[model samples]
Each structure stands twice: as C-alpha cells, then as structure tokens.
Target: MSSNKTNALSRRAFLRNSSLAGGGMIIGFNLLNSCKPKVVAEPTIDLASLDYNDFNAFIKIAENGAVTIFSPNPEIGQGVKTSMPMIIAEELDVAWKDVYVEQGILDTENYTRQVAGGSQSIRHGWDALRETGAKAKHMLVSAAAARWGVDPSECSVSEGVITNAAGETLGYGDVVNEAALLEVPEKVELKKPRDYKIMGKNAGNVDIDKITTGKPLFGLDYKTDGMVYAAVVRPPSFGHKLVSFDDSEARNMPGVIDVVTIGEKVRSLLAEDPSFSSKISSSDKVVVIAKTTWQAFKAKDAIKATWEEETPMESTEQHNKILTDLLDGSKFNTMRSDGNIKKAFAEADQVLERTYESPFLPHNCMEPMNFYANVTSEKVHLVGPIQTPAWKAGLVAKMLGREEKDILLEMTRMGGGFGRRLYGDFVIEAAEISQTINKPVKVVYTREDDMEDGIYRMAIKYRIKAGIKDGKVTAYHLKEAAVNDNMYGLIPNFFPAGAIENYQVDVASYKSNITTGAWRAPYTNFLAFAEQSFFDELAEMMEVDKIQLRLDLLDKVKPEDDERIQYSPDRMKEVIKMAVEKSGWGTKPSNVYQGFVNYYCHNTHVAEVADVEIENGSPVVKKITCVVDCGIVVNPLGAMNQIEGGVIDGVGHSMFGELAFEDGKPTANNFDRYRLIRMKEAPVVETYLMENEYSPTGLGEPTLPPAGGAVANALKAATGNRLYVQPFTKTPELLKVPEKEIIG
Candidate 1:
C-alpha cells in the first residue's frame, strides 16, 4: 500500500471544514466527515446565501461579483485544470483572482471530447472556449449598453467593468440578471492577439494552494459515510484463467465484509458487450470487501486462488530475440514511401545501419489505481480520477446492464495520468464490486498490484538505415518492430518526411499477452532519441555541424506548403535558432559538452540543448535550455512547469527507467527494485517560449521527446560512447556516484 501525504484517504488524520461547490454553494471542496458538505462564510461573498445568474454553460456570475468558470477537461497535472479556465475568463474580461474554477462533470450535451490524452485539451477547445467566453462578454456588454441606450461598440469593457463614452460605469454583476435574458450571439468578435491581457502572461496554477497545503483533491482522498473499502487480487500472470479460489480464511478475517469471485460475473456481463475494452481482463479476478482499508488489505492477503496459464509465459529475453528477428526479416507493412529508396541507396557513397532498443515501461502513477462507485439498481454514482470519463461511463453502463443516463461520473484531480487513466479498467472494477455486494465500494490497488498488473509501454526495436552520398543525405529507411501492435497515427508525416526525398517506413509487430499502450509521448518518445542520435552520427560522419545539418535538410522543404506536411519547417527553424541563440550554442565553455536536438510533435515545435560533464566517471547533466513554439502561451508559469516536468521526466526515465518481465510477470514490483530519477539527479532547466499570434498548441508532451535525445547526444560528446539502449545506466560504467562539489 502507498501512503501519499496529500492523496491517501487513509492518512487523513484531521477533518477540514471547507466549502462546497454547485447549486447555492460556493463551488469548491468539502473535506468533512459528515455526508453533508461544510461551507465557508465569507464577508464580500456570502457563503450561506448567494444568487447566481447562468450566463451560459461555462460561466456563472454571483450578485456580489464572483465568477465561476467550469473546467471541462481532466487535470492530470498537465495544467489544463488551470489554463482551460484562463481562456474562458480572459474573453470574459474577468480578473484571474476573482474567478473560481470548478471541475465540470461528464455532460455530453454541454461538452464533447472530454478526454485528456493526446495533449489536445487546449488545442481542441481553443475555439469553443473563446467563443463561450466571448459570447458571454458580448451579452453582458449589450445589457449595459441597453440600460444607457447607447451603441454596444461604444462601450468598452476592462477588468469586468464597462464604461461608456459618457463616463458611466457598470460592473458585470450589476447587469448580469439583464444579461442572462439577452439572446447569446452565435459568433462574437474575439479579442485580437495584441489586446489579450490574460494570455501570454504569468498566471499561477489554480490548484496550487490545495496541492501545497496537503488538502483533499485527488481521487484517493475522496470519501463518504457508509462507504466500504475493497481490495482486489487479479490474475498473477498474463492471459491466465481462474480455475478456483479459496476465500474461507479471508471471509473470517477481522472487519471482513464479503468475498466475491469475478470469474462468472464480469465475463457474463461483458462477453457479448462490444463497449467493453477488455484491456484489464479482470473477469478472472477476486474481490475482498471490508470495513476499513487496512482490514480489507489484510484479508486480501489471506486469500489464495488457483490459476491456469492460458497463454505463453513470455519473457523479456524472448521478446528481444523476436524483435531482432522481425527487424531482420521481410514481413512488414509500408506505412509511408515517398521516393525510390532502392535506387538512392544503391547509388550512395556510404550506408550506415544501427538498431536501437527500448524496454517496456509502467506508468507508476503516484496515487495508484483507485475509484469510488455506488452501483445501485436505480443509479450508479462514480467519483474518481479518470482521463476518459465519458467513454468509461458508457462501458460501465454496458457492463452493469444499465443505461448511460443512470451512470454519473465525477472526475477528481489526478496525481499523474500520462495516458494510464485513459483506460479506466480500475474504475470498472469498482463498479463491478459494488454491484455484486450491493454497497458503495471504493477500490484501492496496492503498489505491488499496480506495478505487477500494469499496462506497459510496448518494448520496441528500430533499425534506421541512412545512405549518404557526397556529404548529402540520399536515402532514409526506418524499420520498426514492437510487441502487440505496430505504429499508428500521424508519425508518418513527422519532420524529415518531406525534407528527405527518398524516405520509406516499414513496420512489423508481434502479438503479446502483456498489455501495452501509450506511455508519455507514445511512439515519438523513444523515436525522437533514436532518430536524433542517428542524425548527430550522420553529421559527424559527413564532417558537418550538427545544428547546421538539420537546417540544411529543412532547406529542402518550402515553408509555404504547410498543409502538405504535419510540421512546418518555418516553425522548426524558428525554435532551433532561438535555442541556439539562447544557449550560446557555439560559444560554450571549453569544459562544457553540449548536445542539440530539435523535434516537431504534438503540433508544436521544440528544441533542447543539454549541457553535460563527466563527474566521478558518470555523466552529470548540469543544465538544459529549452525553446518552444507552442504559439501564444495561456499561462507562462504553468507552461514552464509543464516543460520542466516533461524534461526532467524524460531525462529521468531515459537514464534509469525500465520494466523487466520474467515468466510473464514483472520482475520489479515496487521502489525496492524500480529506479526513478531523484531531485538531486535532476538538472536545472531554463525554458523560453516562442512569441507568436497563432493559437496555443500542446506543451505537455511535445517538449518531452527531445530531452532524452539531447542528453544522450551530450553524453556521446563527453564519453565518446553512443548510448543506444534506454535506462542508460544499463552501461557498466554509468552507476551511482557522489554529488559534485559546488563552488559558492
């Protein structure tokens, strides 16, 4: 079991008489013991009584001038919880401090595309959010103008205060009631980029107070009266079957409420259901319910079950060998082929080929997998941290033979998602357990359970061969082999696709029983390192500058033909130049080893420079300078946090993150075996955002793919050894070392 000081419900030693949100409430959290929420009484805004006029779906204004903005996307520490609302508040011309942001539930009529994956929260919602806020502001201004009998355009608004040419001022709260009666304009003129005051400015994270003060915000901290705790035990191995289980000892344990086997229950419910994701394969599982969390866990440990292996007990050794064979063989599908690869390669001056390997990785979310479900015959209320609430609501309804309308899902702030909660199998387990026992159940997975039975990043191998002739690139061929599934999505149109005339991508995959899905930046995470490192090698082989070589290659792509390619060469060039100028690229100190990487992914262009030095025979990254062109940044502080987090996460994972499997089971189950980058190991990162009039793109995952590649390239410059494999510590010499002495 994990004990998060902020997220763990079991560790809550004291109760807080906080405020409650929605209806006549103040729109916040109530972390009290009672089933009824506690509210805070304020001076300016009455906590007991307040009348709010609903201007629209996204905005609500109180009589005392407090505005509530509903955040529609899941906040997975991706800054969407804060930035998404900033957009709405900006067009509404409200002060950032006066706004109270509330997490909206799954309402399909008011929201579409509520999932948090793909780093598309801000990108996809840009138009709708601006329109929503702009439309509301238009209505409010029209109301003020109608009272004065003046033209709406003549009345300018600032900081939620409208002032006419005659010097008459009216606060938004004064005319909110009249504004609610006016017809909302379908299309209101959005504020010009030059006039935006909220965007391109530093705004603090909205949940910073709750997070730093150890308040109840995450899914793990949610609790209510009459709620029972549950501990579940899944199959020990992948593709295993539950033959029988002995739960007599568990049912007799202290505080044990009930023991239910899920073999026939879940399978029969989802056997014919197409909505079932079937990723977790939880049908062959068992559940233990009890009065307390510790008691439930104790009883769960006492239970034992018999399992039959229905599939091969796969191993990492076998997977590596299979991937190698597949890469060498010819059974592959051509995803993208631009020019004649054979002719260019046959006429090249030199041919180089090297294979890069990566291991499976687990999400290892800090809070672990948990959910609260009250599955009654009439209504099913689910509260938890999930990225795809709408999609999972449908699946849960189908599994319980209920309608989607009967299921209500409330999203809590997630400790970390990184595409793990995108699959809500744990959420479904809570619903299943609650339906069986006819009680409100909150299921919590132990650290070992979360690590062992994890949906891992697919172990993949890539063989990239490039043909060079006369100091110019002639052909490029990339062959990939992965476990379970091949590459899908827009990776085919990524950078160098249009730059390289003779480009071909071939891929082959082997189906494995182990669950594998998106991890961080998905396929681009490791691919960035592999390809960027290869390009550095090519630059060295051709006696060309590393940064100059990329610019030269992009010179072949026209900046105007932006629609033909997924990434713009102009944007890529801008970030590269900015990184070079800011990092003092060519003018570094003689002792500093610098490596440069430029990448385009997630619809954003980013560049990174890693400064490294060998200390005690180990590579110590001193600092990293990052340049990003995600267009107009909504919140600079939040964007910086996202970039720094992504960089550190990328560097840490690349240096010492990997999951090994033996006999179809994880070899490492907890912190005792798994290695994570620590604070002392993290390097200082400086971020610079590209200023532009274009709308904001994604900063969550786009900046991650290049961090490791830059670090790896820097290590190559210092150690003269190119680290091809992930968890670079796998190298015998890259072991633990003492900290370097700091000169004050």
Candidate 2:
C-alpha cells in the first residue's frame, strides 16, 4: 500500500496557511489537493478484465499494459495537453512508450475545471495528479509484492511491471483485482526533480499529430445526435431588455426550430443583500435562445425587438466625461497618506503633473462562449468549456431547482480562456435554455454577441503629480477614476490599497451602456500599463535611469516600515538586476532601442526589457528579455510558453486592439475589422526564471502588464516622441513636441 501521510510532499513543501494554497493550488480553477483526495468507497474495476471497446474522450488502456492518456485542456496552440500528462505519468512510473493519451470527457467528474486560461493548468495540476498516479502505482506494487511473499522495497517497479531481486516479474495487469480492492491512499510520495523522468524533459504536445492531421477536437468541430446549430440575437445596447418582439418571420425561416424571446426577468423573489457586492444570481437572464444558430441569427434580424436606449453618446465619450468630472470631484477614498501632501507640494521647487488614460478591453478567447446542456425531469447534464466546473455545477443545479448531484458538468477543451471562462455566465445561460426547451440544446454565441454582451475590463484614468526639487524627485500624488467597482470584487484592496504615500484612489461609477466583467489580468492589466508608463516619464524628467528610480523608491518603502507598499522592493530589484545584466542594459546596438518595465502581482515578480526599432515611423519589436521569479518552475517549457503568449497578447492589445461603438451598437465584431497579432507579430523572447525552489506563484498574468508600456517606451526612445494612447494607428507624427528652452 502507498504510505498514507499528509506531510510527505516531495516536490515542494506545502504552505500550511498560504491563501492561494487554500483551494489546493488553484490551476485554471481546478482544486488539486496537495494530499490525495479520500476516495469514498468506489466501485472496483478489474484492470486485467477491463476491455477498451469505445474510443471516448482522449484516453484508453488495455490489459496488455498499453496505456492511453487524453488531452483535456483545449490545444489552442499552447502545449498544455501534452505537458499536463507528463506530471501524471511521472508518478505513475510507467514507460512513455506504454502510455496512451486521450482527451477527457466533457463532464465534471472526469475533469474538474477544464478551461485553459490564466496560465494555471500546469501549476495547479502538478501536485494533485502526481499523487493520483503514485497512489495507483503503489496499489499495483503492493498487490504484486504481497503475492510474492517479498518486501515491497525489494520489488522495483518499471514500465508497468513489478520485478523482484531474483528477476521474477509480474505485469501490473496480473494483480489489478487485488489492487482495486485496497482503500484509496490518502498520501503518496512524489518524485523529486532529479528523478523526474518526463516533467523536465521535452515532450511535445500530445495532440500535435491530431492537430496536424486536422482531427476534430474543438467544440466548433463537435457534433451530436440530432444536433442543430444555434445563434442568439441580443440587444445592440448594454442593459437593454426586450419590450416587444414579433417572431412571425422567424417561424417561417428554413431549418428554424422556434423563435424565443430572451430578455431580463426576475429569477427569484428572494431579497438581495444590500451590503453584499459579490453576489451572482444563478438564473440571471437577458438573452435569446433559438433552434439553429444560423436560424436564430436570421430570425433575430427579421424579428424587431423594441429596445430602450440608456444614453445619448457613445461609451468612450461618456467614460471620458466621467473621468474629467472625477478630476474635480471629491469622492476620493484616501488609499494611503504619509506626511502632509499639501505641505509637500507647496514646499517643492517645481510640481510636475500628467494625466494617464487606459481604455476598456475585451477578453476575446478563440472559442466563443458556448455550452451543451441536456436537461430532463430526472437529471441535468451540462458539457462545454468552463473554468470552474464544481462552482458552475452548483449554480447550474440551483437554476434547475435540482440537487447539486443531479447537475453533471462535462468540460470540453477550451479554445482559450484568459480569465474569460472563470465566470461561467455562458454555462448558466445554456442550462436555463435547456430547462426551458426540455431538450438537449447547445447555446452558442456569435462573435458579435459574445463581444458585445460579455463583461469588459473597466476603463480607468489616472491623474498624477510629483514634486521635483533641484532636478531630484521627492514626493508623489496619484488620483485615479475607476469606471467599475473592483474588477475582481473579491480582491478590492489589491493595488493602491496600502501602498504609495499620499495616494488617493477615488473609484467613481458612471453606469455605462455596456456590460463589464473580468478580462485577462483583471484591473491590473490596465493599471500596471498606466502606472508603469507614468513612472518612465517621471524618470526622464529626473534624469535618472528609470530602473534605478524605481529601485530607489522601492528601497525607501520597506515592507515593515511602510504599509503603503504593494510590491516587494527586494523582489522588484531582483528581477531588474537580473534583466539588466542579461539584456546588456547600458550597452546596446546602435539600431536597437530598448524600453524597461518591472512590476509584481498575482504572487509573482516579472521584469521585461523590450527592444524595438522604428522603420518608416512604425514600431517593430525585435526581441524581449524577460526575468521572472514565480517561486518555483513547475514545467519550464510550459511556463516559458505562457510568458511568451502573455507578452504577445499584451502587445496585441496595446498596439491594435479596441472595441468601438456607434450609438449603442458595437463596430468591431469580427476579425476582419478587429485585428489580432499573428505569428509575424510574435517577438523572440528569452526568459530567465529564478531557480530558487519556493512554492510557485502565478505565471499567467505577470509577464502581460509590462509588455504594453515596454513597447510604448521603446517607441518613444526610437523617435523621441511620447505616444500617449491605445492603438498606434493614430499618426506617430502627431506625438512630436519640440524641447522647451531652459531658464539659467
């Protein structure tokens, strides 16, 4: 039997009271227990007698010691499907050749949180799955050793066989029955880094063969019995409810099932908590569900639903007006205050003031929000791409007024999440539709519906002032206007909470005509962009290197001495020192222009030095040198790929991504007008991960925030012009300003 001990984790020491470790090291919302989960009396399965008849999901095993593993995470070109299995196989102690790989069932039991976003799959799955395989292997070894009347240590396991010192061997399949009868071990010994056979080694994605051969994998490629397509017609404006709809034309369309009106309605008569802000109703609705996606789309165009417009101007104009008003408003909550700010500003030799603005963005995952639900009076089955299946299944059961056990959630491989799939708004929508129709239905949102209806990364404006004395920086004041409540309402006190002296972060709300929700890095995605860029400008005025200025400021704000510091100054210095050394900070080619940015969030530290060159006044990033310390490196290759992808994604958003509105309707719906960074835009990234074996920090979002400002700073360096806006499509020539004459 595998040793049942809780404190024997070999990979890394489990933090007894770590907050992120509470939910079993959340990886893309999967709660993988550091200890093996107690298996409460499961039905026995005889491995030797078991037959592989059907090719379902992605894995299958035979009695002859052939094993197949499946890729559960959707392969949107990120190599998660292959890397995740390496962790499982390492502890299973099976030969790579004997293992067969398969994808997971679109159900919650087979795969918990199967959504691939936030770069969490590998980090979250590392410990839990290794324990699972170790437990299974221990059972097999115990069964064989007991039958041989030999000590378990005397029998070594290799390639699915247990061999004694005398060379007598028995295949794992021979003892499957006895192993199955044993209790599921609570704890199992995990392999150390030195002994890891597959984790650190290079194993390409398991689905590479299938993807190259054009095998059906994605939900777009998924088909079902009597399955029909579906499309929804949502309001053109945000918060729009259907007052009236005439579906006569829709009823006559070809392949039409039925035209249904989906608008906001009271889900429950229960009272909402007046003080609670993080509550989400399971049955919230303001949607349209129809038969075929094409038919629904066509019917939506034909059926005229009366909409009540919220505002007169567009979202951008309204947000800007709100920001301008906030600069004069007094709803400012004093996040932090050190000495007297009024006295500091009055005593300064000169006061420098600047306003920074960042726009709202969309979390455009490759797969549009979709869920397949088969609901009946007996039970409800849900299958689709979702980040948090356990949580989503609870809400789905609540919506259907059934037991939580009745709601079976199957997770399909997501095309991409980037934090979009975590909310599970689409899954609930699909379940409600299935309950209404009393049939197996899959609700699919068109790219337009998905973009326009979904929540957004809130837009923000920052007004900053710094005291400059004799060409030296002294005190700083930052006042911000936040359009939404905290993006991640759970962590309201993230940035500017207790960090920064004389800080006043006023969050003002001007209810917009658009819905807003979590984007990739939540609020930090934009806040870091704005704050890091402003710091760069401040450095230029002080005539000190930007990296040095930040380091000095960080050193002055000690964690113990000052409570207003959000990031650890020591950690920030570590990355900066490493990046500067590796990138040849002071020395560079005459043609290469480099910009530097470093920041910390999500329990991780990252620094980026992006190099660029201006050709014909357009910016072209050549290479990115990144330094990251995320505690531990789970899978070096997987972690590096996430950094590369995140950096590229951030660059794409800063350079050419935005959603424009006309009246209350969205303009950038499809890829034709909404641009994306392709293979050509991807920069060559050289990442250096800190080798200290601390518990892993977040890898998904750390590299993202710095990418935008680094590019912006590099552009300014090449042309001597500061570009202050989202999307460089605006003429770079407009940013040129002649240097002012200095008074002696």
Candidate 3:
C-alpha cells in the first residue's frame, strides 16, 4: 500500500463542488444574480467529469442560486486565477464577493491561448473573457426583458438585479433557466473601463485561503488511491550516458516495489538527437518506483550506476572562452539592421563600447518539479501543475506512443512557475514510469535534483557599441553570443531598434552540453541590464541628463514609420516622464543614488527607478519605484504584487543568482550553495499604475525586465564602478564613501 496520506480536506472540497456543477463544451453559461442576498458555493472543482455541453466552462449558476467562476489558465503565482475571472465577473454584472473561483481543466476545444507564458494570459484572453461575461449578462437581460414584454434596451442590470425603466425589478435567478435556452447573442457590449466595479478594485487572490490555511493546493500535495511514488536518478553529469546499472540492492530496500531501467532508451531518443538537443541535459535517467515518496527517494540512493561521458563535457572556464571567441571572431547572423552601422562607426568622432555577462540561472520554483500520471493501454490521465497543459499533453502522448485523444490533463495551483514549468520533462517522466508499471505514479524531484537537472537560462555575453559625432549619437550596434541558442526573434523589434537611425543587432551561439530555456522575462531579463547600462554610460559621456537622453532617442522613432516597431514612442515617452516625476528622479536626497530606465516587452511598457544607499561601505538597495502603463488595471492589488515581485525577483537575480558548470556539473545544487536575495537585501517597491482607456497588455513579465537595469545603473551611480558580470556580490570592494558622492 502507498504510504502517501490522503488530502482529505482538499479532496472533500473538490468532490463537493464537482457534484454541484454542470457543463463541459463551454458554449455558454447562465450567468444569474439574485437580489435575495448572494449565495457563494464552495470554490472547488475537480473538472474530471461533466455532461452539459451547452453551457460555457467559465461560469456556472447553480439552481440553488450559487455562482462559480472557472479560471482556465494555470495559476502560477501570477494571480491569473483571481484576476482573469474578475474580468468575466465584471461583465457578468455579478457581486464579486459572492462568486467562487475554481481552476478549469485543460479544454483545448473551448479555451485558446491556454499557456501561461510571456505574461500573455490577460492580454490574449481579455477580449474573450469580457465577451464571455458580457454575453452571459446579455442573456440574463434578454430573459428578463421577454418576461416583462419589453426590449433589452429598456432593461439594465445592477448588482444581479435586472430593472426595467419603470423600476419593475426581477432577480436574475428568476429567469436563469430561460436565459440558457435563449439563442446566443451575436454581440454583447462590453463594459467601459470607467464603469468597472470589480476590475480596478482590490480583490483577494482566489487561492489565498487554501494557500494560507495549508490546504492541499500545490502539485506536491496531490495524491490519489493506488498511486505509486517515483524518483528519478539522472546522469551524474551533463554529456554523460548510462552504460549500465545494478538494481539488486534497490529492489531489496524497504518500500521498494520495482526499479525500471529506461535510461538507455531516453539516451537513444533525446540525448543523441541534435535537432532536439539541450532541451534537457542530454543524458540518461533511472526511474525508481516505490510504495511511498520517502521509500522511493531512499531506495534510489542505493542503486549503483556506471556512466560514460559520450560527448564533450562543458565547464564555466571553457564556456567563457567559447563565448568570448564567438563574440570576437564568429560571423554573426544579422537579426536586425537599419542604416549602415559600419560606415557610421568608421566616420564617427568617438566611439564607446561595453560588454555585459550573465551566467546560466536555474529556475528555483518553491515546489520543485513534479507531476502525476496514470497510464493504461487505452487512456492516459495526467494531473499536476503545468503552464503549457495542451502542449505537454501532446508531447507526452507522442513520447508514450499513444494518440493525442487518449491524453487528459488537469491543473493544480502551482507554487511558482517562472517559465520552468513550461517544459513537461517531469510530466513525461511520470507517464513513462506509469506506462511501464501499468499503474498510476507520481514523480517528485528533490531540490538538489531539480537544480542539477535543470533547463537553465542561457549564459550570454552582450557587446554594445555606439558611435558619437559632434554633439550627437550617430550609430549603434549590439552583438550577442549565447550558449545553446540566441535571443528570440521578436527582440530585434524592441525599443532601441527603432530609436537608433543607424543600428544593428547580430547574434551568434556556441552549443554547450548544458540545457537552456526561458526564465521569466526571457532575454529581456538581462538584455535590459546590458542595454540600459550602456545608455546610462552614454548619457554620462555625452554630458546629458539620463532620462533626457532616453526622451531624445524615443523622439527619433515614430510608430508609423517602421513596420516592425512594436513599442510606441508616445507611450514609452509617457512612461519615462512618469518614472522621472513619480520617482522624483531629479530631486532625490544626496545620500540616495537613483537610476532610471524605461523598457517595453511582453507587450507592456514600464519605467523603473532604483534607489541605492551606501551603508557601511556597501551599497544597499533602498527601494525601487515603478510606473507601469499596461493600459487599464485589472486588479490594483494583484498588479502591484506583480510589479513588486518582479522588481524584487529581477534585482535579486542580478545581484546573486548564478549556476556555473564544472566539467558538465553545476556547482550550486541547492539554496545552500546558490545565493538569492533575502529580506534584508530586498528593496521596497512602489508602483504607480497608468490610468488609460487603451486595451490592457501583459503585466507578469514587463516589470521584471527594466528592474535589473535600474538597479545596476543605480549601483554604478553609487560606487563609481561598472560591474559587467551577473552576481554583483562577487565584488565587495565598491567605494566606501558614504558621506558623499563617489563619482557624481
């Protein structure tokens, strides 16, 4: 028998609500509100079974007058589970406090853009969610109007009660059944931003109760009947392969059920293939099956495995040399180009150059990586916290040699995603183990294992040069040399691309055995640091105001002139001024060294200012002030949380996060070896949201990109030294002159 304890509290909650709800196809839902005080149902839905194809998946109105809203996107601490539904609720014209929010299962047929990445959940779903809620309200009003023998134009809804022009009122619950039977409206008017009630207001996170009460909300807490536990032992180091393994001792250990050897197969399928290499460290992995997690973990330690380095092993020292060589001598791919940069540089009176470097960073999600899978001959069931559920489902089906139709996925609230959960390596691992054993299995990764076997953010070096003519900057060029892969294609269309008349972006890469992938804001995370720092240096060298230089550059670009220009100079400039005025950039105290930068990414524009204070010979980040213009705010509190979290996370990583490889093995396997920003080092983040009428953009990632640059620039202002590498903690010799400016 499996030793995993049942999550009775959560299980009971999930079952109770599942029995009360109806609907599957999500064509529409009867969104009803009653004047007779709202009845909020228990907010739990397993989403494992349903029959009503006529209703929408997002909203359910129980006959007993209970309202429940389903949030389909993965809840990865980005607060989408709470905020997304708020958009629907606002259009549904329902009381926010009386509505229950639940996580919806993967329903690719009904939901579009299901993945939670690039901070795009809201931006992509904003229209659909609004229309969904508005249509629901439209049905309710139509039903009320039919009863009153009046048109819908004569009826308006307010707080769940439908009222006629003559003040004749009817509760939405009175005609909900009639509303469901009505024809779907061709169009429904969405609420204006000025009319929003629940949107701009502060609403608590939907999972805060379960999270704060220690309920089984995360994937680690997931459990089911007759499920076995699994732990994997991957190759000792990257580029190594499994020659052979002895499981005699492992099978004999306590609670050990079986030891499955599939490492050789994994190596054949993924490790040796160049087309799909470095997604995970190219290597082998041994799956240890046991009755319990502890037993599986303990038994796995007893297995002895012989490994061989089949490929060239990578080290940090060698990687640094390779990146430097690529930057110097490699013929780079021109990602973007404008006016001739070569001629502009050749004729310039003065030129300035700088390089910034960042090490591969591990995504340290609080829950680590885990997934549960129950695989049978006919069907495969996957349940866990995954960002890309549909994509993972297809990959798992392909790997298991099963049809996509046989796969089913369910999502649980995640502890943190940070782009790590976007890959389904652990999901496939669970599926593979369960397929071999013909039973349900849950695979869990220890923190050490998660770190060692990681798809890290690529270690990259950026070299930027700007040619200056008499009193004006004439040209600019940027080159990126990364490990495994280069920056994404969209980066070429970013801010400076349009701002500089003679500009170019070139990229080159040297493949490494170490794996790499997206981390939070992707390339913009560190690119902002490099680019913004370079711009700051430009301002200093040109004897111009820092914020003014950006304003001047932004003035040079017009959104209409360039087909590739994604950022608006008008919007970008507004934010720059906002940051300067809001942060009091020009009026800070002498003790506080401030740095400001404006950035656009993930479809959101953000400006940030970092305040660094020298205390006891070391620079202490006092605070970060951010002014964000992502259009209208969905939830003020949630938006602020994202900004604060992003700034803290970005600055923290820039200050200390690093994963270095030594002969194909990472030096830091856990928090003990790796340094992160602690509370003492964290700066107070104050955000000012722009009130606008434009449609909303992304929020989760934009705030993070500008933060590193703001902090790095602030440090330079304080210490009069430029630290070009990540992990700013490596140097402690920054000037100790706290009484006055070191260089300013």
What is the descending TM-score order? 3, 1, 2
What are the candidates' C-alpha RMSDs? 7.1, 8.1, 5.5
lDDT of each: 0.80, 0.63, 0.80
Alpha-carbon runs more than 4 Å astray in model 2: 1-62, 67-81, 101-121, 183-188, 264-292, 310-314, 334-352, 467-476, 488-506, 554-571, 734-744
Tens-digit lDDT string for candidate 1 (544-618): 999999999988886466455788888899999999999998788766788899998888999999998667656
Clashes of 2: 27
lDDT of 2 by residue, 520-542 (tens): 76656766666677788888887
TM-score of 1: 0.91
lDDT tens digits by residue: candidate 3, 26-77? 2243222211123122122323343432233466665444566777788899
Q: In candidate 1, which residue ranges exceed 4 Å CA deviation?
A: 1-56, 263-265, 268-278, 488-490, 559-564, 733-744
Using all chains and alpha carbons, the TM-scores for the candidates as numbered come to 0.91, 0.82, 0.92
Residue 578 displacement (Å), model 1: 1.5
- Identify the leading candidate in terms of TM-score: 3
Count the clashes in each prediction.
Answer: 2, 27, 2
